[model samples]
Target: MPLTFTPHPFHPADMPPVTLITDETDDVELARAAHRSANPARGRIAVDPTPATLTSAFLARDILAALGRTAYAPTRAPVITAAPAWRAVACWFIVDGIRELTVLRAHLLTPERAEQLSVLRELTGIRLILLAAPSSATQAARLGTCLAETGLTDGLLRLTADDARAFFTRSLPTTTPLCPTFPLSAAPVSSQPGAARSQYRAGQLAACTWLARHRRATGQVPAQRDLELFLSRLTCLSPDPATTLARIRGAQGGFTAEGLRLSVPHALATAQGPGLSTLPFTARTAHHISRAVPGPPQLAALASLLFTGAHLDRLVQARVDDIDPDGRFLALPQPESAEFDHHNPPPPAWYAVPPSARPFLRAARMFRQLEQVPGHFHLFSKSFGYRLEALVKDAGHLIPALSHLHPGPAWHHQARLTHR
Candidate 1:
């Protein structure tokens, strides 16, 4: 079967034009089409309608799976099996950065089920494509009516099998590379504050000794220029502790393996070093935050809480100026009472934003700047209440720490002060 699509078929908007494709083929063709069309990286999801049930919930389940949402944990199962799957599905679409959805076998869906898909489009702003069999004129007409009512009738393009095949083959946002996924796992590399530091110290001594010994034995002392460059590289501070360490280890291995008769010990090469390889945030927390947090502001806030273990009070006190220009460092000042304004405010404590959290922080900062908030205004105070609370409510379902609060403050904040 041949397929085709427009050269420029996508619009970067929430309510972009929708597409409808009609064709008849063997089951094999349908299977092939579904497989080839699904592009999770581009947020392009292709879901074949369920044969047994054509309900919205089933549709949501298919979309969720296509979007790569898995309910591996018993707690996570509710995300897919919830009473109204649409709500969960909608949240995940935004969180996962979904841009388009394609449903196969559109001709078999009932008007009600089709309407539900329409609602999903409105909620998620994903471009929708429906592929159906042209078995009968009556079915085509019925599908047309469904599309019209649901406002699914936008940028309608008619293409043959060659056109469809080309459409799926060409380069589009749908074919773009995907962002790195940070799955939930054990606590970050630094279980204790000193572990990484100690490891780095141990590795540093080994690396220096090995380099000196190799230079003495091989009479391969570095020239002044080369020594300066090597020193600069060896001491540079990397953004991530783990990644930098990996790069250093890899570099050492390459140097030794490159016919240099010189090689650092495996332990030295693999040891944790002061590099951009820090994992302040837990992998599990990072995974849930991306799927559970609704917006960038919440994403940044929840990430801070998860990594810093700080209360909302500190987050609320954050100033737009608290974050660095690169969105890498955040300085959290103490909350000042309305009653007193110090002549000279104390300097705030600074924290490094993990690589995953930095993007959200940068986005949130830009969002505030677009709204033209004064530099001194609270960065998260405006979003601190329910907006942030909802973050916990949804993410809490999957995050063990926040699961008990019913979407409120962290455990420590639950304590109350009794009034007279």
Candidate 2:
């Protein structure tokens, strides 16, 4: 089968046109003058915050309100307001009504980090409503009260549930064309001791042979850099040079081992690191690999992470201690860590994934893949725990059965582990 690649459907190019928020009759000149004075600095100059800064904040809030009304539905947009000196007050109102607000803590407040936190807040708000409704009507009411108290009555920037549903249901053109036919199966690797070595050799040789043929067919000769990289990975995986060469020369496929290696030269080199030398493949290296052979375990794992909103870095770095054993879930702080204190830490609860995610079993399998890799099992376990946490946080209805599925040390250590 020919290789097929599909990119994400949502791209910057696909976004709607920007809507300007200028008004000739309004205080445009005043806002501009204020902005200039507040940010009067070129290359290395210091900029001072003055009345102009406050005016600029007002302008931004106004623009945001307009954008919310035009770009988002009533239930899905944020409640934007031009409160030049009222942001703190608004925040207090939200906190007072909701009884709490999550704040994330980190070492530095970088611009990128701030942006990420803002996005997380928006996502958390939507998720909270979805997950806490019906069974937690009181919580929903408190959320509504908080919004109302925070001067969100304008309703222009805030979104409602109906608006969110509409957005997800909207149709858009596909970015990546689906493959016509997927290569679903391949022969299993031989496990016989003496035969194992020869089998591996044959596989490697087959890959190299296929790579040569593929290069010839595509008329795109493999690069020397790529060949070296492929050879390097092969050597790392198979200490026995003869077997490595044999497998490269023996495989039969549209894309040869050498050609495939050449196609992803950088990846092949990276995958050859001491840590990955013995592994069959690296997670990053398997994307294209699976396209040539659909339904592979690697593909499934990737799919799961993508669809579940799990952060790859977080998953890779997670430790067993992060899991709440009693809850069998991952605990993600809201408003997030900046909003919480470490000395007197807030109670971290577990989040459970809903059963609906079962459809993406392939993606879930990636956790298993991580587990199989030496030194990564703890990280994988933490990721699994987190996935469960997200499920509980996002699930509309709580299923008691899943509560006990994860029996990690955290659960056993807790005195109230069995309380519903």
Best by TM-score: 1
Against the true structure, what is every candidate's RMSD? 14.3, 22.4
What's the TM-score of each model vs. the native?
Answer: 0.47, 0.24
Runs off by more than 4 Å, candidate 2: 1-118, 121-142, 148-197, 217-220, 228-277, 280-420
Q: TM-score of model 2 relative to the true fold?
A: 0.24
lDDT of 1 by residue, 1-420 (tens): 001111111233537676666666524564466567667765677887667885566776666566555322322213334223454455455545777787777788777777777766665677777677767888788888887786567666665555565565552444434445554454544455665564455445544554566568776644423332242244222324453454445444434443332332244322321232122454444655566443445557766665444445666788878887566667666444454369756445445565656656665565455345688987664356655555566566332223212222221122111111
Worst 10 residues of 2 by lDDT: 39-48
lDDT of each: 0.53, 0.29
What's the alpha carbon RMSD for model 2?
A: 22.4
lDDT for 203 in candidate 2 is 60
Best by lDDT: 1
